[model samples]
Target: MKAKTQRLYLVLGALVALGGAGALAFSTLGDKATYFYAPSDLAGKAAPVEAIRLGGMVEKGSLVKTGETVRFVVTDNVETRQVTYTGILPDLFREGQGVIAEGHIDPASGVFTAETVLAKHDEKYMPPEVAGAMRKVEGKVS
Candidate 1:
């Protein structure tokens, strides 16, 4: 075979391999991806069937505990969404604190059933997405 023909075949094989790898990576990552949203973003929207990450401040006076389960309301001031979570919560979890909950919203009841609840890591640290959302809400209010 000609040297140029050999080189072309090699390049074609490499491109096919790269394409397959890219497709595999995307498919794997897609399954694990969880979209982030603030309370305001959920208002008047159809509840997502897949798991998602909801972030906002825990509304004061909205925490309710029942056995191993806890229910609370998260708010961005513009809107509020009720969240229910079972199992132990993070030690830092508290009312009036920024939180991100991962789970799916019940289309029938509009309640978020969280599989995992994450609290702010420190007193001054807030998730960047949550911070940006709060700022956007504040900007609208002002």
Candidate 2:
């Protein structure tokens, strides 16, 4: 085979391999990707089937606890989502504080059944995403 023809084949083979690798990476990442959203982002939209990370303030006076299970409302001031979790909550978890819950919404009950819940660490700290969302909501309200 000519040198030029051999080089062309090699380049084509590399491109094909790279494309396959890219496709595989994207497919794997898509399966595990968790989208973040504020409660208002979900308002009026069909609930997503895949797991998601919901971030917002724990609405004041909206927490309820039972044996090994807790339920609360997470809100961005424009909308709220009911979240239920059956596990120990973070020590910082409380109403009127920023929180992030990872889970899927139940199709039948329209509730966010959380697998993990995270709370802000301190009074002066909030997740950047949640804080930005809250600022957006405040701007809209003003």
lDDT (10s digit) by residue, model 1, range 11-108: 99999999999999999999999999999889999998789999999999999999999999999989999999999999999999999999999998
Best prediction by TM-score: 1
TM-score of each model, in listed order: 0.92, 0.84
lDDT of 2 by residue, 1-115 (tens): 9999999999999999999999999999999999999998888889999999999999999899999899999999888999999999999999999999999998888899999
In model 1, the runs with Cα more than 4 Å from the true position are none
- Scored against the true structure, residue 87 in model 1 reaches a CA lDDT of 98
CA lDDT, every prediction? 0.95, 0.93
**For every candidate, C-alpha RMSD to the true structure in Å:** 1.4, 2.0
Top candidate, metric lDDT: 1
The clash count of every prediction, one per candidate, is 0, 0
Residues forming the 10-long window of minimal summed lDDT in candidate 2: 37-46
